[model samples]
Target: MTAGAAISRRALLAAGAAVGIGGTLMPARTGLARVPAAFEPTQRLTLSAGETELRLLGPDRPATRIYAYDGDQFRLVRVPRGTRLEARFENGLSEASTVHFHGIRMPNEYDGVPTLTQPVVQPGGSFTYRIPFDDPGTFFFHPHCDETGQAGRGLVGVLLVEDPRDPAFDTEHVLCLKDWRLDDRGGFLPMSEPDGAAKAGTFGATRTVNGRVHLDLTAPAGGDVRLRILNVDSTRVMDIGVEGAEAWLIAIDGHALPPVPMDTLPDGIWRMGPAQRIDVQVRMPMEGGPVTIGDYRASDVFTFATIAAAGRVRRPRRGGPLALPPPKLPLPDLKAAEFHSFTLQQATDAAVKDTGLPPEDPLAKALIDSLCVGGATYWSIAQQSWPTGEARHLPPPLARMEAGKSYRIEIKNETRYPHPVHLHGHAFAVLGSSKGRLPKHFADTVLTQPGEAVEIAFVAAPGDWVFHCHILEHMETGMMGWFRVV
Candidate 1:
């Protein structure tokens, strides 16, 4: 038998044992019912987090010291859908770290939030994660502990779960959009400034696509090209658009949607914030030419990447991208869903408690400074600020619900800047927005504009799931909370 077929058989057997059926594992009443205690992993890999030098500014400039996974800036992890995979993470940095699988809906223990799901891996420590690839789509991973510092220095990687049933494309590319805060000498700058974090989180000075100043790729003329784009920036919002080609958006935040033409959207561009992703299919023109993908938010289009059509013309695929199979997720019963509301705004001094602890010694403070901790609190949710430093005692959950119950949450962004709110362990369906028409779709993160109220609903996933802003600086300070699901 072929190796691929052999692995497929093993995966089938594992799924059968997990669900007590000789077929694919299906969810029983709730999302967590099909989890297995132990199974042979279809794939296993090791990722080490450490500091490395990268010539991000230019080849002639000095290399900047950055943190990355497995010592690579553009590492991509691809696995087949419905398979069990194992990832062992080693922390080589001085501070603690944990890899959070950003948008996969799985068991709570593997969610990777420090102190909530699992303890942080200290320096030279290692942790293994057994993840079930039940849903297939575009996702990414990064350090959950001290994210502002680690991710800002380049600790990010893309994870793609390939679905065999999806239509094949002539060419495909993954683009990770990020920016770096650096000086002319290729030295690092402070990740978060107090004044900047207080309003809109601090932004990067240098922009890049996949850690390059300019990325050039090639494809055949008149072929369908799939572009999986992720905004891995800490605090930059992008209005992505395609130039010199006809493109359609087929997926958002790792979930497939009915393809929509780019021109039909607002101003022919899609607005994406931190931690958000979109899959677009572009049709290369019959004549050999360059197709540009850029951010159109500013007056001058900032072209970051380009794909050149070099080969002879091929017959173009008909129609938009084929719809991917729906994931095995419980549908929320809107009629019976419990309702809750939260306001995102600046925190008041009276609402925040000073963690009255003894000052750290110089030696200890230096270590903490290297990890970029001890930022001032500035934002809050529902008037409650997240406790930091000596106030490690977790506060009561913002809300609680029974497993298998449906809940609808209304998040109102009262602050001046936009907030990309992210919920862990569940993909909520965005119902609507008060300011603009939002396409109803399932996503783990949603960008809420200033003075906008966005509503989302989902069946509660059992765990202490964190709900917070995706902007790292804001989350680090005070704009974070959790929900309890029994």
Candidate 2:
């Protein structure tokens, strides 16, 4: 069957029986109603996006001109679970922009997808987003329009939803890992290169953590430290691991997992792609020592940050890392779920189909066109490239489903490079993979290996959700689609 084509009910049941994929067939529940109706804003804040100067190269070098939210390269917005947040975003740049709350399952209108959910916030204009912190985990927000140019220039921030039930650590730190494409004078290079976007994305020349060339901090000896690492880079994938400290992999993409020893994982490291997050608990040894965190995927191994065990011992090290509270999400009934499939591959002119779609506003189209990096379409999903510059209409959704219905989606990566497939407005369980075994966990983005097939199951949330590669270059070039849940 073709991608996005629905399987017959009888065939679906037969396949489920043959595979023994078991789950209780429960009545579909309206998941949208789970969001409280009388949520009042507990906190209000304003974020202004504009160009800022930062000495990215070094103190002796010229400051780089980059875009940032609230004049900071790494801004942290913490909202406690069960509370509501109202944030006003002011676009101070000369171009249009929108803020997408990555991994947050909120109302569709506030999703921040320009023209899809809300119009672009033009220059000097503002838009307010009312978000409910229902699920507590490590999430982020970034511009949905001109993603490659905007995000690569540093328009990204980390959003942490505090879960009161989560265990408190002696020291907690959040690291935002990103790369910069800068010249010797600290000026930005081209954000996207046609040849790079057509294949693997263009990698940045420099790497940093929390916008600093080197990050060093002190922690109490014999104490447990929680490190929340986020890969906010537009193109780079990192193999993150810690040295000189015993650490446990406690979470992935914000959601908690059974605490597993980092040493037990493959190669004692976890591969993190763009827009992915990982939470690790490190136990400092009694004696003073430096615990270094670095990206092992690099040729010489880049150490981005280090935590020294200095101050007096806070407490004796615990036996194991504490597990975080599981998020309350609707579980998918795989037995009765509808099946759909999508293939990620290279784009071709003949693959572009005219799906009946509504005409886009001329102004919005112009704004999007102006921000587009190039006129070439390089990647696609299910043989359909998302409409870009000069396209008169928006692309139709890859699939449409009834609200609250269970769905099992199989995404096959047919390209030469890995793609981190991200679905907005809902979190899905990684069922399994054809290449290897996967840990039991829930996430909004899954990094699929080239030529590998991965399956994910979730209960459809109400809204028009974007499904695309997390690699910003691939997404902008064409590897993007949407799903409509009515």
Candidate 3:
């Protein structure tokens, strides 16, 4: 995890980039999934938001108007691990916007929460984000302001940090899993309804990866592949598994785990909630065939992508995995850790409203209160809604902590649906679980299964930080709050 061994994106995707055996012309492709494009980040990248053409309805009708960064369709964003991720974001949409590095622990000033970390980048304006990529794994970037509309209309992308020293695979495929809510002619339906937000949040009608209805991919025969998969869905939970090949679970939420074979798991699948990531490796048979990566969370399992085998068998045997690299993260003093518990779930009629606490500026409070009255307040955490509606409302911190202190929190989900819970600043060790003991890996976001509780511990960093549900609607409704570390 040392800094400064970074390779420029240009070198990584050079035309004659050397592979295990031969100089590759391009990354192998299969099915409807095309090969990953060159994400050449030359010091800085210029990303803008504007209406772009979408082919959700095929070639007959006009392209739909959907917001996007770089292009209407998103692809893999590759950068060296431990490099400074610098980008200038231009807002071309009709509203204010800011980009949130979904899982990166960037500086407090560039965290990108509108009115909380920095002022929103207004329409026609621009802002530059400088994030240091200390840890490598799967992550994403999307707008934080008006997320229900901003992200729901498509503005999402996957950022992959290249770990050169980590376990080497023949080649890897990057899958940005997402779902969309669109009508005939590829027009977007309503972002969300009050009823949908009040319940399971809003679910999209169409599922996709890299902006396509079905992803087609190709891999070399008799070789190992690393599947870098991300769930960018606004609300849907995906159960991911690979078919037609033997696989191993290598990482989760960007942190490398012990290489566990998929056959050891209950049903050879990993449950991924919104904003979560899972890396799996599969071996192509020596003879040759096609493999389909799938989502089985629904009653009828569906293929997320298809990878066909091509060419001659380069490597006859799929050997053992390379030595897993350790994440460069700080350690917490578990013996001296303080413990606290919090509950988040759907709001009931008898939900308790936190009252008689510290007050805020009257005008700001009034505006937020008015918005809450007009909009929805469908969820709650400890019986209170932070900001009530928009990020403008300044609510009191849910809890204040002394800087450098180790803390353990038991986050319990009382709702029926699982949440991809995210903490803003620091990564935590997932100490234990409701079902059994667990491997405590470092993660900014953790998937809490329905009606299950997980205990996580971390050291308190000095800053104002937030914790919320990654399901955008849940956060908009009420499943969001913040704590201050002094």
Best by TM-score: 2
In model 1, which regions exceed 4 Å deviation?
Answer: 1-36, 350-373
Candidate 2 C-alpha lDDT tens digits along 1-486: 001011123224333333432222111221122335676898999988898899888878899988899998877898888778888888777666778899988877778776567766666567887788788889999988778778888999899999989988888999999999899989778777778888878899888888787799878888888999999999988898999989998988888888888888778998878999999999887875699999999688999999997775645854667888776888999999999999998988787665644455222332332333234678899988776545534577799888999999999999999899999989899998898746778999999988899999999987778899988878877788888888
TM of each candidate vs. truth:
0.88, 0.89, 0.85
Relative to the unseen true structure, what is the Cα RMSD of model 2? 11.4
For model 2, the stretches where C-alpha displacement exceeds 4 angstroms are 1-39, 358-374
Going through the candidates in the order shown, the clash numbers are 0, 0, 8
lDDT of 1 by residue, 1-486 (tens): 001112223324433433421121111121122346676788899989898999989999989998898888957899999888888888777566778899887777777776566655666667777788888899999988778877888989899999998887889999999999899999878777778788887888889998887799988898888899999998898999998888988889988888888888989999999999999988888874699999998897779989998784456676665566666667899999999999998988875544322344111111221122334668888887666443454545678788899999999999999999999989899999997757888999999999999999999978768899998888887888878788
The alpha-carbon deviation from the true structure for residue 371 of candidate 2, after best TM-score superposition, in angstroms, is 3.7
**Candidate RMSDs in order:** 11.0, 11.4, 12.1
Per-model CA lDDT versus the true structure: 0.79, 0.80, 0.70
Supply candidate 2's per-residue lDDT for 306.
91
Ranking of candidates on TM-score, top first: 2, 1, 3
RMSD of 3: 12.1
